[model samples]
Target: MSPLPTDAPILPLSQTVSAQRPGDAPALVAALERCRAEDGAFAYSAGREIGTFRIEARTLNELAQRLAGVTAVAAVALETGPIAIQPCWTPGRLAEAEHRLGSADGGTGDFAVVRLRIVPRRSGEGNIFETEFAGPPEIDALNAAVARGVARASAEGVEGEGRIIDTRVVFIDGAFHPKRSTPAGFEEAAIAAMRAACRTAGLRRLEPLMEIEIMAERDHVLPVVNDLATRGGSELRRRLAQKGVAIAAELPLRAFLTYEGDLAALTQARAKIIGEPQLARWAEVRRR
Candidate 1:
């Protein structure tokens, strides 16, 4: 694949007011806050948590590098709309620039940032940010390409990969070849950048968990609840239904390894289990 130019800038998003046009500040901030707050649950899968943020700096490679140094961050992407900020920032450079430019003179350009944590899973506990971006048609296409690539790579998330497939990466900035820059090229770049960030930030294993509801005959309630307990599942709510007991629980995906068969054996295939995507949490890091 062709290499991204050395000078390709990855800018940090800023939440600043626009002097003329409605700076992407308000809508961007609203979107980011909403996403972060509501990022509590998802129906799909992808790598890592996704967030959007407003851009303040012109370039983010330095900032990303600094974040990678945090030892807990796994990866970071500052993007929304068609533009994306490649993983490249260094904290030292940003600090130096800030010191040199001073607060008032230091310009926080207009853009959005997306931060991804690699080590510790937030488990729907902490705040996840969000942002929005507007760019040319090419930018939109580039963002789509990045999404498609990441999704394809993460397709096995629910199939027992033990990873989330909901990695949200969008374009914040890049160099386009016009003739040479196809979605494939840009997609490779996006994935490469994220992987690079992960390497720098470190990776941790996290398992996708499911929020499940099970309905069974009255006679089977005790047995089913026992089964859940054995598999590390938690019974959240239980009520008597018209014909049986209704059970709500939280279960790790791994427990499903024999769940289908076990449920059949325990309830004689008469029990119903409803599964929905739930927040992911950190698990023991698997050693190679």
Candidate 2:
């Protein structure tokens, strides 16, 4: 067969603000509190235990600069908005840059600035790619290409081979012209702009995340969960659903060694499973 095209569009995102190893917990908390006091929209997402909070910041840099001044900054956590990230799929040059960015010490030197380049997975194209690097910390002086690289490669996360397919980044660029561009046009143009840049950067698609939700009886939850763990899962979240005593776990979509029918028989039809694309960001699919 003939080779497919590798010219999919790429987008870059720069994290708004970041806080390096703040000194102590109380100080960091204070900085976060200060951020909350400001007025604006802030989006945050962390692990179930980590907990995410968003208040407001007129500008990301303003917030980061303030947070940086905090005493107990351990590792600067960059706001995931339009920041540069690095992963394996990144180009050798970008990879090297990431290394330099991460080499510095947080205390004496700049924060380890890593960049993850994310490439989209076009049909017959190839796998999505992401590259990581380390460097000094900053508010939002990140390059555009690097941010898109991270988003594309992270299209499906690191779990599913090609299941999860959405990693959108909200960027505030250009003006909303009535004849030139509308509000929606501005949004799409932002995505397209990044996508075009991705093509120029020469990055490709990487693995996506998956959600293999399993519905089973209460008694079978343990066994089902165990079986899922036996397989490779980059990140998994488990929760018991309403009725059916359903035990649903967001697992990698690539896991296909076990059969649902057999599992059903083993659990006497009390167990059922289903999987589908967890589309949150398709690099440039949805409207931001």
Cα lDDT computed for each candidate against the true fold: 0.42, 0.36
Task: Name the weakest run of 10 consecutive residues (lDDT summed) in model 1.
Answer: 91-100
Candidate 1 lDDT by residue in tens digits, 1-288:
111122122222222221122343344344434443553321111222233332223323433332222212212222323322112111111010000111223334222122222222234332111213336677666556555543333332222232232233323344443444466655555444444444454434444345678889988888888878777676788888786888987665566545767898888898977554343343332221
* TM-score to native of every candidate shown: 0.35, 0.28
Q: Listing every candidate in turn, what is its Cα RMSD in Å to the true structure after a full C-alpha superposition?
A: 20.2, 18.8
CA deviation > 4 Å runs, candidate 1:
1-141, 156-163, 177-180, 198-227, 241-246, 256-288
Tens-place lDDT per residue, model 2, 1-288, is: 111112332221113333333334344455555543562333222222233222222233544554354323434354323322211132111211112221222323222223223333333243333222223342122323334433433342333122223222223222222223222322233334444334455544432223456677778877776666664332245565675554445433233324466567668878876554241222211111
* Candidate 1, residue 153: how far the Cα is off, in Å: 3.5
Each model's total of backbone clashes: 37, 71
